[model samples]
Target: MRAAILQSSTGIDPLLSARNMVEAVERAAGEGADMLFTPEMSNLLDRDKARAAGSIVAEADDVVLAATREAAAKAGLWVHIGSLAVKADRGTAPYANRGFVIDDTGDIRARYDKIHLFDVDLPTGESWRESNSYVPGDRVVAVDTPWGRLGLSVCYDLRFPDLYFALSDAGATMLAIPAAFTVPTGRAHWHVLQRARAIESAAFVIAAAQVGHHADGRDTFGHSLVIDPWGDVLLDMGEETGLGYAEIDPAKIDEARGRIPVLAHRRALGAVEVAR
Candidate 1:
């Protein structure tokens, strides 16, 4: 399967970002890609919640989602908009960082809200309290695609191996871990974590990321990557903001799983007893 990874520099303006994404959809379709993957917060990325509130809306009312769906149908290309800030169905938190899988016909195939909210005070002096604005999702989503059963996840979710385990346990052959990571963390752990996820799951891992400075005055680490099941990097779009394509062979999934056989050997262990 030909996958197009869009490493984007998101802006505070949702409408402008939506237009840019539409153009990218056309480009991906023209390049003959089967699927297009975008970075997290593709619609808007503003650090200031007060200013961003005007742009964030319900999933049905979001112009970015609407535009991307229309573009997907027009181009006859599958699209995965990494995550859009949308109004949550039920929560004290006003919004949800949600990902979408849109089919070639402009139909939404699946929706996955970010479950693991990033609540940390980083050493680099960048503190993120995602739970403040967005509520966590209860469901784990695995969807069917032309390529294979694809698992859906968002930015901070990459750090949780148990999520990947659940996805693979659910019979996912490939994983989409789109992110908008901070620069300090990305420089230190991005590549290693992505490779580890692929190696552990024995599945293809595609991560499209946000890069460089944004309209909101924050910086992001931008190395959008694609890894095969054997932990080999297939495509790594370094720093620059643009589109990167990679070919995913379903056969590789079988080959890696057959060699490692870890998935088969996996056993459910009981809670550990404290040595103390």
Candidate 2:
């Protein structure tokens, strides 16, 4: 299976972003990518709380989601939109930071809302409280694909290893992380952490990320990568605002699992007594 990772500059213009993503998908398809992915907040990213509040909408009625589904169908590939802010619940103000998996037929196969909220103050004086604007998802989402079982996650979720372990326990072979990671955090922990997740879970890690500065004056570290089961980056989309592609070999999954039987050597940690 071939994969395409897309990176884009941030903008208030959701329509333009959608168009750019469609074009990128087309290009990746031309390169024979079976799966295509976009970075977090691929539709829009506005740091202004008031602006993001007013601009974000609910559901596929949002033009960007509609265009993405159409693009996925046209390309006949698995299209993963990292995360988009959409309306949730009734008449509520906060939106859902959701990720979607669209199949070749353009049907939404699975959806995962971001579970880990980025609510922290960086040492650089940059503070983010995502929970202030979005509602967290309560469920863990995994989907079965032609390639293998896939686990879905978004930005900030990368820091939580238990989630990946849960998905791996459920037979996930590939993990998707669509993110708009801050430059500070990405620089410090991005690649190493991503590789660690792949190595620990023995699963393929495909992270598509936002790159460059946004209209909101926020800059994201763009280094979209696809790592194999052995924790090797198959494709890296440095700092460029474009797309990258890689092939997925399911046999690699078997080979890695066979070499180190970490998944099989499981002991009942649940029965362990905690030391007071």
Candidate 3:
């Protein structure tokens, strides 16, 4: 299967971003791509809390989601909407950062809310408190697709290896990590963490990323990448807003696992206490 990863800057306007994604979807479909992957917050990226709270709506009401679904149906291909900020229930944290997997018929196959919230104070004087606006999800999600069994995770989830291990154990052959990563952190840890996950799990890693400066005054590290199970970088979109394509060969997964067999070699570790 051929997959297309889109690295683009998303602003606060949902309709505009959706239009851009639709165009990209058409292009990818024309190029014979079976699946299209987008970055997190593909709908909107607003720095102002009040504006974001007021603008973001439920998935059903979101123009971006609706538009993307239509595009997928028209193209007759699968689309992994990396993540969208959607309004939550009345009592929840007002919103949820959610990922959606849409099939060829434009029906939603799976939905996963982001488990980890990015709450940090950066050395560059940039701070984000995602918990203030979005509720964290508890379940780890993986879905079956024509390409392979896919594991789902978002930006901050990339920092946690145990989650990937669990997914790999659950029979995920490929992992999707859609992100809107801050520039500083992305520069420091992005490639290393992604390669580590692929190498350890012997699974294909597809990471679609947000890039460049947005209207909200936030800059992201844009290096959307697709890595094979053997830790080979297939495609990397450097600091640019565009679409990149890569082939997904199931044979590679089998070959990588057969050579390493790391997952089969496991041992239980008893609890250890530290001596003063």
Candidate 4:
């Protein structure tokens, strides 16, 4: 399957972001791509809680999602919108970090709210308390597409192996890890983590990422990558934000799994025995 990865420098403005996404859809379609993938916080990425409120809206009312869906339908290209900040039930949390799978017909195939919220204080004097603003989701989402079973996940979720394992066990041949990573972490762990996830799951890993400086007063590590099941990097759009294309052959998943048979050998651990 032909795939297009969009590495964008998302800002605090949702309208500009929506326009960019629509243009990306059109360009990807014109380029003969079968599908288009975007980075996390495709609509709005702001560190400030109060300042972001103006653009954040319910999924039903989001202009970006609506525009992307319409663009996808018009282009006849499937789109994996990395993630968008949307209004959630106030009782639970003020918002949700959500991802979407829009089919060529402009229909929502699946929705995955980012379960693992990033709540940490980095050594760079940057602190994020995602849980303070967005409620974590409890569902694992995967959907059937022209490219095969696609598992959905957002940025911080890449660190967890259990999620990918479940997705692979659920017959997912491809994993989407869309992220807006900090410069420090991106420079250190991005490539290795992405490769490791693909290697273990024996599935293709597609990562579209936020790149460079943004209007939100933050810097992002911008090496968007695509890894094969064998852990080989196919396309790495480093720093530059635009449309990057890659070709995926579904047969590779079986090839890698056949070589390792890791999934078949997977076993649940009963207990940890204390050592003397």
Tell me each candidate's TM-score.
0.99, 0.95, 0.97, 0.98
**lDDT tens digits by residue: candidate 4, 1-276:** 899999999999888998999999999999999999999999998987789998899999999999999999999999999999999854478899999999999999999999898999999999989998999989999999977999999999999999999999899999999999999999899999999999999999999999999997899998999999999999999999899999999889889999999889988788999999
Q: What are the lDDT scores of the predictions, listed in order?
A: 0.95, 0.87, 0.93, 0.94
Q: What is the number of backbone collisions in each predicted candidate, taken in the order shown?
A: 0, 2, 0, 0
Give the candidate number with the greatest TM-score. 1
Ranking of predictions according to lDDT: 1, 4, 3, 2
Q: Which of the two, 3 or 4, has more TM-score?
A: 4
- For candidate 1, write residues 1-276 as lDDT tens digits: 999999999999988998999999999999989999999999999988899999999999999999999999999999999999999998789999999999999999999999999999988788889999999998999999988999999989999999999999999999999999999999999999999999999999999999999988899999999999999999999999999999999999999999998799877789999997
Misplaced by over 4 Å in model 2 are: 90-93, 271-276
Q: Alpha-carbon error at 75 in model 1, in Å?
A: 0.9
Give the number of the best model, judged by lDDT: 1
Off by over 4 Å in 4: none
Q: List the residue pairs that clash in candidate 2.
A: 1-248, 58-87
* RMSD per model, one decimal: 0.8, 1.6, 1.2, 1.0
TM-score of model 4 (CA atoms): 0.98
Better candidate by TM-score, 1 or 3: 1
